[model samples]
Target: MANRTAMIDVGGGFRAIYGAGVMDRMMEDHVHVDHCYGVSAGSANMVSYISGQHGRSHTFYTQYAFRKEYASFDSYIKNHNYANLDYVYGTLSNHDGENPVDYEAFEKNPTGFTVVACNADDGSTKYFDKSDVSYDNFDIMKASSAVPVACEPYVIDGVPYYDGGIADPIPVQKAIDDGYDRIVVILTRPKDTVREQKKDIGPATILKRTHPEAAEKLMNRYQTYNDEVALAKEYEKDGRVLILAPESMYGLNTLSKSFEGLERMYRAGYAAAAAIPAFLGS
Candidate 1:
């Protein structure tokens, strides 16, 4: 069988069950995600999947990640000082304060996991590995999903960082190096049915007011995203990438919307992941 890795994209708050749910279905259907690489919210899902990120059987993230715990920053802030009204941290240090996703327990063993984040100051995509690093899942989670305005950036190696999707939405190259001959990517963005006009909008229009600079950078990257999407399409054409579209996906990046519609995304993920065989066989 060809080695495989799923390259999941981060869509800020829009990434509830998109990645994790897709991953679970893939495993259940025998599509087994041998390796996973994710950015932004996708990074959060990686941590959950690696830790069996559930409190009990059939919990499937519902107990913790999907509960009011992750849905709002209120409860999490009691345990973490880094939390803000918009940005949050320190929840997954351990699963229900047990089954910690530490490097000592998880390093260099079992399935592969990689988390990606961007430098807040320079807008660079940096990658972290589960097998290669001594850091815990919480550390990776902070850096991977640290969007400039929405959350506080993790001070990793003394550099401030933000969402990795700004630089590497789909880390296809990294997945290739990780020995996955077949690559699967799940995007929170639905396929565009109509061309979007490239009109300049204020930072507040594209990013939260708190992240002024990164917001400007993100708006500029919309064009850059076009390039990455083109490259992904090329991979699909060559049979190197198997893309799972967000069929009927709404709310591109907002937690409330993602939470409100968790079941929908979960079922959508199941359907999308189930189609992998057809994509591969075709």
Candidate 2:
């Protein structure tokens, strides 16, 4: 059997709804994953995929994503963070105790589950695994999803960490280093889309002036994403990597809250996954 790994990229905000559809289709097709890696919003999707709760992930986007409190401007005004960490934590905690994630299954998983976060102080990447006792799954997930100014850094053992995408967006290199024979990457954007090279303006201008370090990290993330895209293409030739991306995302962006747009992205993701012939065999 091939040692298969899934590398889910950091989809911006509700754009991660697309990843849910990809995961759901993969599960429905019975694609076996030996290892899983994710950063930022992708970490949430990773948890759902590994736990076989893609339905819950779907509900999260379709039902809970549009809540005014989820990404409240009021929270941003008061706390300097648009993301309501408390609300996010409560939702993921499964407070009702119904259909809790099977953390124990991580032990049985081949290469186990891994989430990446960026150390805020040193600007270094941190990889947290289920086997690591230093931080629990929630800590890892929260830290990984903490998107700089959009979401406050999560403190673990007195050290703060932000979104893993700041350091490594799509960690195809990490999966390659881990000895996965084949890797399947789920991308939120179209494969051929070119990143805009416009000068920093508006919020980016403010970020650079106030939080230069955060600005630098964002730049690094962009460079890393481009580099990984090149690497993925090179690996694709050898059948070592397969990438699934939407042909187009219409006008939907990371922060789009339109229900119609979110639904379109979700369906596109599902169709992309289903169209991959490799998945049928896997």
Candidate 3:
């Protein structure tokens, strides 16, 4: 039987929460996702959902990952966000019953999971099947979370890896090939426009000092966003894909407020929830 898939893309910083909000509301309406495919923060989101903590995503992000104690001074200087202040570290590192996260549940759950990771040296993407990866959920997420300079590569089997967003942000085609007939995608990034202003400053600029290619990816991220956005519309014409763009979202620049406010994050799911009945023709 063909499966149903829910996909979320790579939105750096807190902007990725839009996908989480969408997933949370979908659960409330009993939308069953046979498998979830995600990159970067989206990968982390899928683990939380599979573990049944979808509703508490806000608290998880605000209180845990962004907690004052977790965000170390070194984290602020090295990686833009407090990657070291990661809440998953506590959950995955400790391996306790306090949280629903862990590799065991993800590996055994009825709903499938796939986390995307990129090899830093070769720039190759590795898709870790939930049932196949040997590491804990946190480790799997860390592999894909190598957010350029902000995130350190997840070293596994002697290879350093980073976020897959640099290459494959959304794996919609992969989900389709995996036999998912109906596809729903939540995007935290903006829809592609004909023209985007050129940015000559910031991380992309600073990064040129060492890693030029990484800097290029940062500078061209808007183009990447547009390319991914366009692909959704092309896939929708095939009769099985639904693209859910958040009605409102804070820009990626504002890290602190990206997932803030009562309606911002959940709004992504709410908009999609309202569209589902019609999409289903029920």
Per-candidate local distance difference test: 0.59, 0.71, 0.62
The candidate, 1 or 3, that scores higher on TM-score is 3
Candidate 3 structure quality by residue, lDDT tens digits, 143-253: 777666665567777876667676567677778788876777766655543325264247557656755655665566557656766777788887677777654554443
Give residue 35's error in model 1 in angstroms: 2.7
In candidate 1, which residue ranges exceed 4 Å CA deviation?
1-6, 51-89, 95-108, 131-137, 177-179, 193-216, 258-260, 277-282
Q: Which stretches of candidate 2 lie over 4 Å from their true place?
A: 95-111, 132-137, 197-212, 275-282
TM-score of model number 2: 0.87
Best by lDDT: 2
Predicted candidate 1 versus true structure: per-residue lDDT over 1-282, tens digit per residue: 544545555544554466666767755665545677867667666655554533221243344555454545664455332223222334345434433454444454466778887776666667887743455336666676655544566677788777676667667767776666677777666644221325425432545454555556566666656666666778888887877766666544454554446666766776777777666444
Candidate 2 clash pair list: none
Q: Which is the winner by TM-score between candidate 1 and candidate 2? A: 2
Question: Model 2: which ten-residue window has the lowest total lDDT?
Answer: 196-205
Ranked candidates (TM-score, high to low)? 2, 3, 1
Write model 2 residue lDDT over 105-132, tens digit each, in one string. Answer: 5345564677888887767889988665
Q: Output the better candidate (2/3) by lDDT.
A: 2
Give the distance in Å from residue 25's predicted Cα in candidate 2 to where it truly belongs: 1.0
* Cα lDDT for residue 156, candidate 2: 87
Listed in order, each prediction's TM-score against the native is 0.75, 0.87, 0.80
Lowest lDDT block of 10, candidate 1: 79-88
Model 2, residue 10: C-alpha shift (Å): 3.0
The residue pairs found clashing in candidate 3 are 146-163
| Candidate 3 Cα RMSD (Å) | 3.5
